[model samples]
Target: MDLPRAFTIRESSHRVCNPFTTEKLALLGRAISPSPGTRMLDLACGKGEMLCTWARDHGVSGTGVDISTVFLSAARARAAELGVADRIGFVHGGAAGYVADDPVGIAACVGATWIGSGMPGTVELLRRSLAPGGMMLVGEPYWRREPPDQATVEACHAERKDDFLPLPELLRRFGELGCDVVEMVLADQDSWDRYVAAQWLNIRRWLDANPDDELAAEMRAELAASPVKYATYEREYLGWGVFVLMNH
Candidate 1:
């Protein structure tokens, strides 16, 4: 019904929750250049930034589903702020296995691909809601470089080295899924900093206001440890991007 308190606290200030800045997001939207009136389905659509912005810039209509009521509220407000409220809908529910009533011009499972277990399953789930010839957008992380050790892998927030593929192999994965790699907008180190570094501020602010909260200690420890961890491992080893794919 709602996201974990930790997640909500960490991302409370984020409009787009992945390692993408506003420029990269705009670049991705323009690259795809969804035709006016195109329909989109975005699963686990954090704060509905993609759909709302597309509705404003490209005139696309869409539905965004997420389990977090907090994010859904932010999404609705964003739609209104962007004056695209009529063009998009926000649903507070689990995104896993959810499909649109009709095939859409774009179907996406960004960042939260765990909804379908992994990349392949998430791609299949998106395909179920995509119209013929429509594109699918997947936001995923890849290994920027092979980690030198298990400690590095763990520092990068991966359980194992295989948790993410190198960039070339990741593209090959789309091919394996029977999709063409049509377009992609990748996150640079600065973008990753924007995504990860901003969380510290949000968590710090939350801690200041709610010192007695049960999660405060955890947030403080994360705030203390995250910067070193990110700069050391994730910034160098992990890369994230939103890839556009088409059925082959």
Candidate 2:
């Protein structure tokens, strides 16, 4: 029901649980520019950065649902820190089957689409809570370039080459699903580095402070291999973006 301690540890410093920088995330908010008092529901909303920041910047209000108590705590703290505590709420719960009782202006599942099994299922789940003319925000990875072999796929943390599509095909998928791709903000290599490289520092710092912790050995091994693996495979082959969609 919760994210593993290892994952929480690795992403301890992340404001958003994906490969997006604060600047880029703000860009998305500005790009969409939701009106004041817009209501939103964000599923699997790790740390609630988007809700808090958007509330502060765009005057929106929302509820965020997440499985991780740790993340929810951070999210609450962030809401307070951003002076949007009254504008946003965070709930600790399963996101897969959760839907807002009332339709919302925005429905989102960013970087945790597995909560709804995959893209199609996640879109359906989000749709349940969307108001007419409302938008959906989906964060996903696509292939920047086709991985040449199974080893490359595994290195990119995918089990199969087909796990992600190229950008054009992904846009086509949105069309097939009866949504229009209105706007998108993509993650570049630098943003990916910031997101992934921060994990190494967090791991090393945690290991330094808690040498005997049970997960230390595994994290240590990951830290050793992740840098090169990321540079070679994921950085070269994987692309991540948050797409804004409206029903067609």
How many backbone clashes does every candidate have?
Answer: 0, 0
Worst 10 residues of 1 by lDDT: 154-163
* Model 1 lDDT tens row, 1-248: 78888998999999999999888889999999999999999999999999999999999998999999899999999999999999899888999999999999999988988899888999999999999999999999999988999999888777889988999999998999999999999999999999999999999999999999999888999999999988999999999999999999
Error of 2 at 198 (Å): 0.7
lDDT score at residue 62, model 1, on the 0-100 scale = 89
- Estimate, for each residue in 39-94, the C-alpha lDDT of model 2 and write its tens digit: 99999999999999999999999999999999999999999998999989998999
- The alpha-carbon deviation from the true structure for residue 113 of candidate 2, after best TM-score superposition, in angstroms, is 0.9
- Clashes by residue pair, model 1: none
The whole-model C-alpha lDDT of candidate 1 against the native structure comes to 0.94
Weakest ten-residue segment in model 2 by summed lDDT: 155-164
TM-score, each model?
0.98, 0.98
